[model samples]
Target: MANALCDTRHISYAGCVAQTFLFVFLMSAEYSVLTIMSYDRYVAICKPLHYGTLMDSRACATMAAAAWASGVLNALLHTANTFSLPFCQGNAVDQFFCEIPQILKLSCSNSYLREVGLIFCSVLVLFGCFVFIVVSYVQIFRAVLKMPSEQGRHKAFSTCLPHLAVVSLFVTTGFFANLRPPSISSPSLDLVVSFLYSVVPPTFNPIIYSMRNQELRDAVRKMMSWPHFSRHKLLFCLYI
Candidate 1:
């Protein structure tokens, strides 16, 4: 919109490249963290006895850091490969953002081959994490089934089901958006799928978690009530 606002339909090469890097980095980080969260849930549910030891504060922080680092690495690799290619098709980015797929479409050179390799590597990594999440859930389901109390099983399932739902939404939409055949690619379809995977999940994830997790629900309620509570406390102080 900056270009639109300024009546200048151009972005600096560096700015365009940076935006592309951020796009890849942020997506990679989100998926990596979600994968870690699935494992955290697995440890919490399938091995409650070892949860504290396995997912200590330090361990969680380390995992988070690793996720971020991996994202940066992936972004750097792809960004370098992508921009190294010549954009003979002109500077008019078809997508709203500097998306790799859209930008690659503008490349008149075969330099996109390197970027394709990076994309394949990224897909492999994502697939591996997807498999890990699936295995973790399978174990979690088995563990839940063996629980003696119905209420306990319900609680476990409730906590897990939302994460699985979100993951499925994210993965399926992303797969469709990114892996769609070029022969069938439509601008409207791309926009809708991109919005579904990239925009919708992040916006609705908190709602999903708050709805399903009692602890988070209570926390949100407390936060929402804080202003009223503060006003009441101030009134009580004045009355006293």
Candidate 2:
């Protein structure tokens, strides 16, 4: 944003490193949180009786801490490994952000194989988390299907579907952005894919969740009507 406003594309070495670390950390943490949310939904829908006991405040706090810790560890490993490489190629990055793949493009050494290996391992971990989410949702759906009441099923679907939509959007876009074939890669395509995974999910998440909340919707409606109501009251007072 600062660069765009200033009409300059230059980023300092330290700024690049910071951006890389922060981007990876936040993205990793978001995935972890999403995984945890799947578990939460599973417990709520599948084992309602034990939900409180299983997802207690302490347990939630512990999981949250672990997620942040994993993010930090991931960021440290990728940032350290990536910036350590010598860049003989030009510093220009194809993507809008300081991502690992874009940074790897700037490296001109065989040592980049190390970072590639690390990325593969990271992908495996992320895949495991995705599988966990899938399994949890399967269980949740099964339980929802077993419910006798139509309203109950509808409520369960309503709660779970938004989360599933968000997870699908996040995971699919990210996977495509990172794993797409090189033959079809271009600057514009990369930027668009990057925006989809990096920008769209976060931008939509709150809207998706808030839209499901009846109280929030009501509040928003009331807020929207307030100016009109105030104008009517002022006119009546002037006429009186």
Candidate 3:
């Protein structure tokens, strides 16, 4: 925002470092939370009898704490490793934000190899989480399909599908943004991919969740019928 207002592209070194740290920390935490949410849906649908016991308040808190802790650790490692490298490729980052891969492009030292190795390990961990989510959903769908009542199945799908959609959007865009081939990469393509992964999911998550809520949907529908209210106004409200 400041850059746009001032018509300038430069960011202070400290500002860039801080941005990188916060961005990684928040994204990592969000992904971890999403993984935990998949487990939540799995328990709710696959093991309804054990849901209360398994997903008790204490367990949820513990999982939440672990997610944040992992994010902090990940941010610390990546941020420290990324900034420690010598930069001879100039300070200009190709992407809008101070992304790790973009920062890596500016390195003039072999030590960046260590960060690359760390990223590979992180990707493996993320892949494991992705696999877990997929397996959980598989079990959930199997259980849902076995339900004797159509209403029960509908309810289960309603609760789970929004979450699955959010996860899919998050994972696919993120994977492509970070792992796409260098051969096809261009500044325009990179910018769009980065925006899709970083901005779109968070922007749409609340709206997606709200759309699943009967009460909220009804309220929005009613509001839309008001003479004073417009579609743009409702959209602004949703975005807020």
TM-scores of all predicted structures: 0.84, 0.91, 0.93
Instruction: Report the C-alpha lDDT of model 3 over 1-240, residue by residue, as the tens digit.
Output: 899999999999999999999999999999999999999999999999999999999999999999999999999999999999999999899989899989999999999999999999999999999999999999999999999999999999999988999999999999998888889899899999999999999999999888987899899899888866887787889999
Question: Mind sharing the TM-score for model 1?
Answer: 0.84
Tens digits of per-residue lDDT, candidate 2, 119-223, equal 999999999999999999999989998999999999999999888989999999999998999999988898899999999999999998889989999998897
**What local distance difference test score does each model get?**
0.88, 0.93, 0.94
Please give the TM-score that candidate 2 achieves against the real structure.
0.91
Model 1 gets an lDDT of 0.88
Q: List the residue pairs that clash in candidate 1.
A: none
Error of 1 at 66 (Å): 0.5
Clashes of 1: 0
Rank by TM-score (best first): 3, 2, 1
Question: Rank order by lDDT, top first?
Answer: 3, 2, 1
Q: Which ten residues in a row have the lowest lDDT in candidate 1?
A: 205-214
**TM-score comparison, 1 vs 2, better candidate:** 2
The candidate that wins on lDDT is: 3
The clash count for each model shown is 0, 0, 0
lDDT of 1 by residue, 1-240 (tens): 688899886778899899888888988998999999999989999889999999999999999999999999999999999988988888888766678888998999987988888899889999999999999999999999999999999989888888888898889988988788888888887878778877888887887777876787888789758988879988999999
Clashes of 3: 0
